[model samples]
Target: MKQFCQTCLAGLMSVFVMFGFSISEEVQAEETGQTAYVDVSVATLWSEPNETRPVDAPSIGNPVDMWEWTTGMSYEQKLWLVGNLQTQALYGQEVTILEEQGDWVKVAVHGQPTPKNDLGYPAWMPKSQLANDASFSTLKDIKEFAQVTDPTAWLFEDKHRSDKFKEISFNTRLPVVAETKDAILVATPSDGKKWMSPDAVSIYSSQEDIEKPDGQNLVDTGLKFLGLPYLWAGTSGFGFDCSGFTHTIFKAHGITIPRDSSVQATHGTPVERDDLQKGDLLFFAYNEGEGRVHHVGMYMGNGKMIHSPNTASTVEIIDVFESDYYSSEYAGARRYID
Candidate 1:
């Protein structure tokens, strides 16, 4: 009886090994709650796991080739991304893994708000772009963080800036490990640690420590991207869509807003057209302001607004009433900031 029991135990252990399951691994997964961080400079979230096309290969590469990804797409291909490409998450952003299928994972991005999920905006992204390091979960406890203030910044492997680690987009926040007079040591999602120049970032003790900027500050930040080519569903300095441009501009100032234009039109304080302030969000609809909300722009005061209009346009300032299309479809405005 003893010999038979030993054999059975050995067989069970083999089965566990074959299935790649262990007590420690199970405990680690439970502790982490399947949390992962974006490992790439920008991880594009898709409406579905299989929504990517052949031309999207460059966008998914390890060091995402944003330039090739944008310049390579044809006009039609760019328009196709309007609905199929959901949104994007910057490097080091935390996401709660909801589901996994093959090489893709459905995650709720922490900062982006949406009605699709109470946790955050829901979207599917390639699994390879995420880092599942258990150590990264501890970042939530770190009070001090370094936020990228510039349009773009490079992460260095050393303080001397000898080796380039990665080029991160604006608004990317990472837990600060240490700081020097000219550089900051930050904890990365995949890479162990990297250094950033103080000139490109601002240190905040906590999210509450960030001082809120007024409406004009928002416009000043938006103005930096003038002439940047528009990209559908883009949320990085490399490119931006209509709502993405507004969302990123607000996010850089420590404000969290909805990820979609239609959803964004619902929240925030409603402002009358005559009372519109600089940085107020102006929305547009399908049927002369009566139909579904489809587009959004930041009010630039004096009858102008800044927006990434469409795939064919760049980040430009335009007279809101200059174009008949926008004037006829103007849907009211909303104020996210007081």
Candidate 2:
């Protein structure tokens, strides 16, 4: 990736700033230190709105919605566990990190964000690395998460877990790198490297891992609807706005994210376009008036994104920085599950 001027890359000007990449369908061999864990916690529910208290509060039983990590702090790793069983997640909702009190979280969710709640991301994740002796499963046998439901909201199920809440699942994973220096567990061997020692925990969750599957088709399947139609505050399949489309995609993949384009920027770890991974989100503030994001898209790897533009625009795929529309509106780039 060619370098762009830092000053020019700020604000909407960054939108037009262009870069190019080449993506492939090859699954590289194993290497050491290739694992990670997404440190996920249920968003704390608010009791009341102090507005001035910094954090927003929710009514009783509202259920805290969406999963959040600091910029560069949270990431979903892509681990090739069990032949080809892998998972990719995008937070498909609105989240606002509160300031103080509940201020650490900003919450606006169409669905619930906890395991006990009816609406949550439920999947079977592996607690250990792939079997060194097992052969890779045929792609035909691997099942995509969405095939299991409609109006899908993420919820976890512990098929291998007898502990009820503690599930033993084995899928590819990512890490929250914003808060830490290295990636976490449930890793695959990259290149020729050996497994990395666990950093800060005894157990890890692959659901929080970054979104890099073993094949290009995974990313392709996640971003197939690059340009559909932009709807205002839309969270459905037929018509979706920029943030709406992005939030929904990640939801199907089993990760809850902030809703609005601006607030969504605050979740996950921060990464430059040059270092972006698939399923990561990109944000733009064509008009940085509210200190928020007006336009957003999903980083489908390579140089393309899946997003919904304005009322006059169609949900489609376009060069991130190639058009003046995004160029002039470009905000900073962020990676939630990277």
Candidate 3:
């Protein structure tokens, strides 16, 4: 009987190994280190634990045609063009530390997942980027939080329009102290309570705001980012990717959309290309009418669309049907608002 039982146990262990279910709760706990929140308003998530290579450095998988584009650009322009593939973690963003070495830490960032990492959008951020503040872990302690609606906002020293200090990017969350007629009082990322123009902010007192997605207001708010640089995976006016641009714009209006173009394509009711209206999201893929969406933009009426295009470009208005690239690649559209 003992010999028979030992053989059965070995068979069961083999089954477990074959299916790849070896990690137990204790093992998982041992692998996962500390949980931390992003300490600053924004932190860059790098592809590797090391510092990002200089913008002018040759990219590993870059297309052969891009060599000309890279050489024609100046060093400063190349620097601006770089870092589009990296994503950003916002203030109070939660992440789990997986491994640490020296000053860099590998973390699984929480939010709309990206295709970059199977382990919940894994990336490397500097150790100084994380915070263990009790405030982040306990949201009930916060009375209210101000959501930045503008592409970029400034906290003025006073409401009288003199002496401005800190500048915050879009989609940043800050705790609100008071609400006045013209301004909302909130703690600046670097300073104490300060007044910011009410027009540039949306105050959320309750969690029901998600039920009300203001598409018109979202489109109007997105217009403020015109002429801003295009940063890959950016969700702020400091820079923005196509989906990040749309996501932050809708977030300002209390509608939370996914963080990538492919996922955003699956959201909302599908709209016919001819029926495209302001605030409608347009998607594009390389295969003309079929295939995975790789880009997104907001329709601006009269055959025009607003988007961040790609690297070496800024947020700009384009004739959607007039541009061969967009016209040929146009996949479809969707309406998320009433």
Candidate 4:
């Protein structure tokens, strides 16, 4: 009887192994929920299942309290990237849980895009970074809110950065409950009422602002972050990835585009390199004739293009044909705003 029982147990374990099921996996499956927000200062997105890399970390200027550290981020533009990776989602960016693979969770980020037949802005992030406290919703909700339009806008307890309360990224939309002449009162989920400069935000009255497809002032809006540092996978002015620079630039002008360079390459009408105009998106690859579209830039006429090149770089205008590296890898151009 004992020998028969041992054989049955062995068969059960083999069955479970063949089907790729484990006791711990079942526990994680039950604990994982739908949507989650980045609770930390910043959450970095990963390309593969196990990948998270930090970029150019800023020198921690004279140590100060939380308020000073948060406040100085605006004028000094320092101390924010201490231990963060380049491809990051700011504090409030929402992500939806798709599936759980051990300690990693495959998620689809809001406002980001993936290929047609694939999941939405699909990426794998550590399950620990996912939080359950905050609720995630679409950007079109019928609330009178102020959309952040600067590289990093500080929400002050009073009016200016001197009385800084908190800091938020460029694309983060905050609910506006009241307004003063110089500042707008915004309601945040984690923090209560906070005041921000009126000029730093664009107030939306109706859904027209969200649905508008015209790239009215994209290039001009993009030029605002000329001196900002480049972070990997960053989608806001606080720090911008190459594609993130294009994504947020278009968002400010009221157009929704894909998030990644490769996916964005498949968007918009194709244009010839010789016919490139202002506001047209230019992409690059590895080889001379062919490679995966890995980088993107916005043409600013005069043979110049604006891009957040890499982790050690900042948003800047560069000659498309000036450097042999960029000129050689030039893939093609696409016009999103016609």
Q: Per-residue lDDT tens digits of candidate 4, residues 1-338?
A: 65466567658766876899675543333334487765433455554444332222121111112233323344224334422332455555677788786777767777666663143566666776655553223322445778887766777887554697656677777667788898888765454567889878888865356654443366777778887776656775556778988987886666778887897898899999888888889999977738899999998888889998975578999988887889999999999887
Who is ahead in lDDT, 2 or 4?
Answer: 4
Per-candidate TM-score against the hidden true structure: 0.88, 0.39, 0.73, 0.74
- Model 4 alpha-carbon drift over 4 Å, by segment: 1-22, 25-33, 39-41, 47-86, 99-106, 116-119, 124-140, 158-162, 210-216
Give per-residue CA lDDT, model 1, range 42-143, as digits (tens): 999997775688999988767787878889999999988877888899998989898766677889998899889887888888889998777666874654
Over 1-338, each residue of candidate 3 has an lDDT whose tens digit, in order, gives: 65466567658756876899784532222335677776555566665554444542332211111223335456466455344345666665667888775567778776546565544557677777676766545552456777776666777788654777556667777677778797877764333457788888777765455446455566677778788766666766677888988877776666666778888898889999778888899999977859889999998888888898787788899998999888898889988888
Query: What TM-score would you give candidate 2 relative to the actual structure?
Result: 0.39
Which structure among the candidates has the greatest TM-score? 1
> Candidate 3: lDDT over CA atoms?
0.69
Candidate lDDT (C-alpha), each: 0.87, 0.38, 0.69, 0.67
Q: Please estimate how well model 1 matches the true structure, expressed as its whole-model Cα lDDT.
A: 0.87
Q: Which number leads on lDDT?
A: 1
What would you estimate as the lDDT of candidate 4?
Answer: 0.67
Ranking by TM-score: 1, 4, 3, 2
lDDT of 2 by residue, 235-265 (tens): 4433355665666556445566665566678
> Could you report the Cα RMSD, in angstroms, for every candidate shown?
9.3, 20.5, 9.8, 8.3
